[model samples]
Target: MTQELGPLAREVAMSYYEDALPAHDRFHAKRVRDVSIRLANECDEPVDRDVLSAAAWLHDIGRPLERTNEIDDHDEWGAREAAALLEAEGVTSDRIEAVACCIRTHSIRSSSPEPETLEAKLLFDADKLDAVGARGLVRLACIVGERSGRTGERHAVIDDTSVFGTIASDQPDISLLRKWARERLDRLYTSPGRRLGESRWEFMEDFFAQFDAEIGVDGKR
Candidate 1:
């Protein structure tokens, strides 16, 4: 029997994401987990609460502790740290391994690392999904807010600061962006996702249109 490891997931997630040294924190992990859970449900995939939850929660463990200062690439670092943490938590060796697999491949743009299991794919999709919708919009803003110049570091970090911050500030310097959060909300690879994501996407489009015309991007009114 597989371990559900429900509360354990939350506890582990908190331990890493909530950093005191300006490191990325649990909120980001939770958002990743949120996307993973949603994808799992939508895909009718077996959600290994232990693996999925742990991976999702631990996905960004290395973010706040970045050493390189790049803040744009850190998926591998997160995987390494997450493995250590899960092993410490006494997760079964097998489950621990599976969790590691998912964590390792969570980042999609890492040279197209292939996900072997459904869990990995779900986590990957969820992480990216969060970056494309309204929620993604908020994350983009945060990314922009955190962008700093390069630095020496140990843990891998992300560089979403520019794109992310631009979204939040509403001044990304790029005009005529027809494919924004609202615009992306309508696109889902799965049917269930479309059901939940479509309405939200529509709402975002409407909200964005309010500012779009005012900005003269669409040249309306």
Candidate 2:
């Protein structure tokens, strides 16, 4: 199934992300898709892999449009886009609906219609998992650099305040990064997700501890 749909999905996804920053491009989608498939394989629950594959590939389809104000919400927009793509591929309507639902609610910030299906949960978990630990830090740094018009300053952008909360501007980057990792850890859903998240969270915590120690923050000698 993936052998048939994977190429089509990737082609569509790549077109949308053509002008996207490296952090939010095809590589990111591929990682999320791979992680989602892995989690589905590990889980005892029954999941439709074809639906999962299509959902994972189209999850971020709305990001570019949302960034330009052409759409209000990326998840909702992406869901519509995924449905169209799946229909074009001759996927069954029921399966297409399942895929669309997964794309619709895969976001960490999404509130309504939370992921109930195993496939959706895996997609959500996989997507959030990518936003933690070392890779997550690298991704955030790239976004920050893009927003700040500077390359790798390690400072959170004022306009993009998702991780930093309402803290003072003087707070260290390590503190902000730690806060984000903790938040991500708290949001894991599946058993495999929790296990993967624990290790990643610990890695982030350890990295921050070492960083603070080197910088002499928190009264470190």
TM-score of each: 0.68, 0.83
Q: In model 2, where is the ten-residue run with the lowest total lDDT?
A: 156-165
Model 1, position 144, has a per-residue lDDT of: 45
Show where candidate 2 strays beyond 4 Å: 1-3, 110-112, 146-172, 216-221
For residues 170-191, what per-residue lDDT tens digits would candidate 1 score against the true structure? 2233222225443334333445
Per-residue lDDT over 20-48 for candidate 2, one digit per residue giving the tens place of the 0 to 100 score: 77767778898899988888888987878
- What local distance difference test score does each model get? 0.60, 0.76
Q: For model 1, what is the alpha-carbon lDDT of residue 59?
A: 73
RMSD of each candidate?
A: 7.5, 5.2
